[model samples]
Target: MGRALAGAVVAAAVAVATLTGCSLRIEEASCGGGEYPVLAVNSGGGDCVPDGEEPAQGWARYPEGKVPEKVGDEWDIYWSTHTLDENGEIIELPEGG
Candidate 1:
């Protein structure tokens, strides 16, 4: 009886671990249908705009080489403290950035 109980407990533990592991997919942040994301040029702000619409005033498309594909991704992190000047040059943000 003791051996059987211990075997059952081990099986249950394995089942629990398998179930949890199967559900551990990392979901990516997304912009839902018909919209795309853009970042504010000189600030830590962003938005999702419709596919046919342009970024609003004070905001701009991320530069070709540095566009972020996911929230908190490498490019996204870099953009938080950097921006493009009017001439399209990359510049470090001011203090308190």
Candidate 2:
């Protein structure tokens, strides 16, 4: 009886861990109003760099909220920005082209 109870407890623990253990990985985290869980800042809304006509050329923060220039080799950022602007235009950077 004790063995059966122990097995059941272990099974329950494993199930809980599987359901809540950082499984939902973000692909592109952006800073927007409609975004659900943005892990980084949105670089398109603010003032872009000089001589930059496109937002894609601007620098965006990583998923961990670190600037692209500040992040190190060990840092890995994942995010997916699918939202659009007021004109209903999907703003995508030039990279990944």
Model 2 over residues 1-97: C-alpha lDDT tens digits?
9999999998888788788893433343222333222122332332223232223433332334332321222222222332233443445533552
TM-scores of the candidates are 0.64, 0.23
lDDT by residue for model 1 (1-97), tens? 9999999998888788798885434646646778777776766667788899998888777788777777778987888888876666788988775
Off by over 4 Å in 2: 22-97
lDDT score at residue 21, model 1, on the 0-100 scale: 83
lDDT for position 69 in model 2: 26
Clashes of each: 0, 5
- Please give the RMSD to the true structure for each candidate, in Å: 7.1, 12.9
Number of clashes found in candidate 1 = 0
